[model samples]
Target: MYIILFNLLSWVTFFVFLFVLYLLILWMWGNMTAKVPFVGVPSKVLHEIEKALDINDDSVVYDLGCGDGKVLFYLYKKNPKATYIGIENSSFPTILAKTRNWWHKKFNTSKIEIIKKDFFEVDLSNATHIFTYLYPSLMDDLLPKLDKELKSGTKLVSASFHFTTKKEIKEIDLKRGRYQLTNKIYVYEF
Candidate 1:
């Protein structure tokens, strides 16, 4: 029994070490290749946006820089009939998000896609709703592209970063209740 316990402990330690190493490599690669690190939207902020948007079943949702597809999954859970597209540039998070999409495809059987490419390269013309948690500089660059691609009346929800465009319709601020940190989600109609 002691020997079996020792073997199990050794295996657990080895896997933990490997997982840590994998995360370190992903961090290095993300810093080198992508402009921003993989940061997820806080749950409170996500809920606030979901409540505000009241996404319909037929809406097409695009999540730019969708790290691990948390936002997509949340939205999917809320309304499985809606189509979700996650565009992730980084390799590791994209792989994880694809794996998640596969699992969802096998189980929930929804229209969800995870593409490992730059968000800028994808066309947003058909999107009925768009979501992003990008930095201010990237947001500035993306505003023109969104304006040119998305049709009029498309809704956009930006978390933590505000665009300079005059299209903003609503803003909701929520406190995380820790770290004295507060986040804001901006809603815009184009």
Candidate 2:
């Protein structure tokens, strides 16, 4: 009798947890679609960007909607002098970035900062390059902001979706059919 009750309780808890996770996903999507929806950059894509963009020590890259901060981590490893900043609104990912950066700092490594705030509010005049994988709607909203804030030569690298309803010629299409990578990243220079 006791075993039966415990099993039922466990099943109930599991279902409840699933429902909670589902609700959280929707809530997060509503708040920060592609912008901060916890997407770490794909390894192949990251390498491709490094080669194409010629990521140097002087590049100041900001990954908008930087989830668990994998892109920033990759950038830090690639170029030590490159200042990497990630603007993430979610609490969990912000904490993750903070902890990871703290550990790296303790070991005397690259300077990676994760700001737990909305990217739309931050000043982007100093950003040499901006990396993002946000959804189309969010990107659309950010388009005007970028146009106003970012300088003429600033680079914008977008993953998965485009902001405006326009075709990009300088896009990198990788692993289209059988390969795992589904999103085609577009790079634009302003």
Can you give the lDDT of residue 93 in candidate 1?
Answer: 87
Cα misplacement distance, residue 53 of candidate 1 (Å): 2.6
Candidate 1 versus truth, CA RMSD in Å, comes to 3.1
- Model 2 C-alpha lDDT per residue in residues 1-190, reported as the tens digit of each score: 9999999999999999997787677557645743435656677778776654556778888988887788888877778888899988876667678888888898866678889888989999888988887778988888888889988878887877776764454787776566565357788877
Say which candidate scores most in lDDT.
1
Over the stretch 1-190, how does candidate 1's per-residue lDDT look in tens digits? 9999999999999999999899789868896877878878877666787876678988999999999999999989989999999999997888789988888788878888999889899999999999988888999899889889999989988887888755579888675555633367788898
**Which has the greatest TM-score?**
1
Model 2 bad stretches (over 4 Å)? 1-36, 165-169, 176-182
The TM-score that candidate 2 achieves is: 0.77
Clashing pairs in 2: 34-134, 34-135, 152-190
TM-score of each: 0.85, 0.77
